[model samples]
Target: MKPLLSICCTSYNHENYIKETLDGFLMQKTNFPIEILIHDDASTDRSAEIIKEYAQKDGRIITILQTENQYSKKIKPWPNFLFPMAKGKYLALCEGDDYWIDPLKLQKQVDFLETHSDFNICFNASKIYIQDTNTFKEDPFRGKFPEILTIKDLARKNYIRTNTVVMRNNFTLPEWFNQLPFGDWPMYLIMIKDNKVKYIDDVMGVYRIHSEGVWSGKDKAKMIEMTLIGLDMLIKSNILPAHINKILLKRYRKYAFKAQKEKFRGYLKNR
Candidate 1:
């Protein structure tokens, strides 16, 4: 039987936290079947072994143990590897380091998307665990926007937390998606095209902010530059509305200005 939901999890050197991640998936209280498709990008740690152990315990888990690191070679696990294998009506994403706090996280998001046909994506709030400080921070977008969101609203900012999102598996990812440094934001933008986004207020998971994590490790200026590049690709793709194009253009100028100012400040500090 095809699963109602398919979880695509990618792990690399998450030996310390992969067990918690797997437990979060297993503890879900749902009526329908779900498949966990986990890919270990040649982890030089015990992540793969831990994943294998969990797979043995649960029939829902299917894993790929890679001999070579795909990300290092610029291969995205979602579009290229894991997503292709997902055979579910809805798709959920979680990294190895992140864990869902509420077992009903999947159940609630799935319930929302199941009932609401007009919305393609349903996402909720998450707590950010600052590993360096050993503290928890509330999601920045918590209670920030109304229930329903449009392309323009999303264009202004990204409120959807990756781990907290469950989106319809109705569209194929574009080939251009592989060119970006990151995938989640662009994926959300492309997925929400011509569809509304529903934001759930519940806190479902914890996103670890660690120095080893990719995006968390980057400086503000670098992060803005990456965002601009992703938006530039979206603009070239000709998928966004005219108003959104203008919004994106204005966004970059602001981001670019900020990046420039940050760069100038760094230069002065170094001198």
Candidate 2:
């Protein structure tokens, strides 16, 4: 029988955390079949090696390695290039640095989606866990909310962790989606443009935050430019509400200012 869900994992240099992420997938207790497609983005570390090791033991695990780095200096169109490769009716996601804590996550989400025909995507709230300090942080976006959110709510900061989402592969993006300022934000927006997303307010996954992460780097000027550029793209696209665009613009400005201050302080201290 065909697998009901395809768990797509996109990883870079995450050797330290990839094991837990894979373990989470392997540990799932679903009655239906599932497949895991782990694509390593040409990491200099042992990440690819680790994935190969896991694939060796698990028949359902498949590993895709890039010949050269696809997204080191810049983002590459992952879903556009990778979605064609997915085999299941539903597409789920997991970052190598994050994992699912709930074994029934996939089962629950699949059941909900199969029953609720209106939902194009189904996701749950997650606990943002910082690795180094081993501390738990709350991502405000992950807070409890209504059973479903419209396209307007999806426009806000990505409330659903990448690992927590199970989307119907209805919309495919152009090559430019990978170039967007935020990967998940654009994808979420695209998914919800016509159909609303179902929310299961349970904490089903863990999102690891660390210093070397893509969003953890110390380059505020570049981030500010990227945010502005992204805002311009949204304005031109005309798919979201005007109020949502205005709110995001204000939030980006605040983030840019904070990033600028921190970056300048770091530079002065180093100098």
Candidate 3:
């Protein structure tokens, strides 16, 4: 049977959690065939060995082990380089560090997309687990949006979770997607601008927050810099006028600055 979905998982230094993540995929309660494309991005830890071990056991899992680390390269080669290799009509992504909490996640999303041909992508809400407390944070943006989201909605707030997003691979990813500050933000914006995105309104995945995590480790100043870059793109794309962009950018910039300063303070205290 042809696989109905292709899962693109990026793995790097996630040996401790890769097994759980793979287990989540294996537990999916779907009748349709599913295939996994696991990319081990030259992890220095035992993550590559773990992924290979699982692939050896599971026929549905396909593993890609890189000999060299790709993170130091100036250009980002994420789903962009991996998407073309996906064999399914729909792409369901689950990074090595993250795992699905609900086994029915794939089935539910697949059914929704298969039934609703008009919707290009669908995403559900997710639980944000902070490693410090090992507790899930309150996610206010966990609900369904209108059939189509505007650029303004995307600009005003980013509600989509990368772990929950299941998008149709019909359209070529926008060139700017790779350069955009946050990977998911650009991809969501591109889909919103070009196609109809639906919300599933369920928290079916857990996004682990740890010190080593890329998004979690980013300092406030760096985050603000990235946000500004995104703001500039939106303004240039004509999604927001100059005045609106300026006001919003200033508002977010302040928050970013505060965060940066606080992080610096923590560093100094530790030092």
Candidate 4:
């Protein structure tokens, strides 16, 4: 039987946390079948070995264990690998370092999407685990979240937590998506263009903030630069409405100022 949901997970050197993530998938209580599609980007650690052990036990777990590091080779895992193999009507995302807290996470999200045809995506609030500080904080994107989200709202800022997201798998990846340094923000912007996004408000997952995390580890300057580049790509693609573009441009300026501030701070420190 075909699975109704595909949980796409991408990991590299997450040996310490992969088990928790895999267990989260296994714990989901759903009436429909769900396939777990995991891609291990050739970790130097035992992440691949651990994934192999889990795959051996679970028939629902599908894996792509790369021989060489794909990210270093500049491969985009989603479009180039995972998405093509995903055979689900709806796609759920959870990185290997993060885990779903609520066992009913998938069931609740799937139920919402099943009833609400107008909403293209559904995401719940998540708790943030700061690895360095060893503290837990509420997801900043959580409070007062709107029931329906538009492109303009996304363009202004990305409030959706990546691990908390689940969207219909009806869209194609643009060539420009491959060129971007980051993924979630632009992907959400593209997905919500014709469809509305819904917020679930419940805390169903945890987003780990560690030094090795892709975005969490990046300095302010690099982060600002990449954000502006993503906004510029959105503007050039001409996929968004004029009003949304204007909002994006405004955000681009805001990031540009932040980047300049970071540069000045670096100069002062070096001097």
User: Which candidate wins on TM-score?
Assistant: 4
RMSD of each: 1.2, 3.1, 3.9, 1.1
For model 2, where is the 10-residue window of minimal lDDT?
Answer: 73-82
List model 1 lDDT by residue over 13-93, tens digit each. 999989888988988999899999999999999999999988998899999889998888778899998888999999999
Ranking by TM-score: 4, 1, 2, 3
lDDT of each: 0.88, 0.80, 0.75, 0.89
User: What are the per-residue Cα lDDT tens digits for candidate 4 across 1-271?
Assistant: 9999999999999999999999989999999999999999999999999999999999999999998988876677888888999999999998889999899999999999999888889998899999899999987767655867877677777888888999999888787788888888888887776778888888999999998998887877888888888888888898878888899888888888888889899999999
Error of 4 at 16 (Å): 0.9
Indicate the residue-level lDDT of 89 in model 4. 96
lDDT of 3 at 270: 100
Q: What's the lDDT for candidate 3?
A: 0.75
For candidate 3, list the clashing residue pairs, or say none.
none
Ranking by lDDT: 4, 1, 2, 3
Model 1 clash pairs are none
Q: Could you give candidate 2's per-residue lDDT for residues 1-271 as a string of tens digits?
A: 7888888898889999999999999999998898898888889999999999999999999888876887754655257445777888898988889999999999999999888878899998888888789999776775445678887776655567788899886777756666677687677887676678898888889988888877645366766667667766765676666777776677667766776787888799999
Q: How far out, in Å, is residue 229 in model 3?
A: 2.4
Best by lDDT: 4
Worst 10 residues of 4 by lDDT: 139-148
